[model samples]
Target: MNDFSPALYEVLYVSTLATDQPLSVVAEIAGRARIANAQLEITGLLIFDGQRFCQQLEGPKKQVLKLIERIRNDPRHTNVEVIHHGPLAGRRFQHFSLAFSTVEDEDALARMEQLDGSAALAAFENVCEELEL
Candidate 1:
């Protein structure tokens, strides 16, 4: 029996939205991401403020890497920072979604900030471990 597990890659990207870009702009970007995810079999979460976006993408390692490279080359974003990345034991998100919220939505912002933090990554690992996915 083949014991090899599928490689899972996770990346956290932070990018600035163009100044005065409309909400429709974000929607367009999210629409593109959704299409890419569907085509690539990637799953993850996208979070955005009016002017910035932070997202996590997890999937087969090679595919995720290719997707990230494409995202870097895309002109829709500037100042993209890859905050976290590595092989994940399992997927963090079961499907792709663009979850929109404002900075004024303090609780939501705080949750996303936590996910972006070092501590939460460890916690995420623990959760994945417990779930045994």
Candidate 2:
């Protein structure tokens, strides 16, 4: 019971958003999600490089899927793409309801240059490691 099984834990996906939504709007969205996710036993990281949003949500399989559907319907998000999804042997962000990172506007634009592949994901992960968030 004390061990975490990859078969039992799930990290829904890694998604990056494209939209005209402002940073404040994104922050507000994270705030709301944080409250709700806490109740649902969800933990995740929300990384926004201003223009794009890269998030990783981990929780029970069913709840994670439902949240993904809700996110798809949210008007604030457009061109939402699930980069990767699968069960995890461990949680990348277990201490948070929704951890957030805000990238400067200039950095955001620069990140786009690297977004064509895994570089983007690596950049976000670097931020998480750097900030220990």
Cα error of candidate 2 at position 90, Å: 1.4
Q: Which consecutive 10 residues in model 1 have the weakest lDDT in total? A: 124-133
Instruction: Evaluate all candidate structures by whole-model CA lDDT and list the values in order.
Output: 0.64, 0.66
lDDT (tens digit, per residue) of candidate 2 on 1-133: 1245234344323334545555578768988999998887778887766566667788777888889889888878776666556676677787888988765554642443445445555655666665545
Per-model TM against the reference: 0.70, 0.73
Per-residue lDDT value at 15 in model 2: 36
Query: Poorest 10 consecutive residues of model 2 by lDDT?
Result: 1-10
Model 1 TM-score, 2 decimals: 0.70
lDDT tens readout by residue for model 1, 46-119:
66656667677877788888888887887777767776788788665664333333344424423444455565
Clashing pairs in 1: none
Instruction: Report how far residue 130 has shifted in candidate 1, in Å.
Output: 21
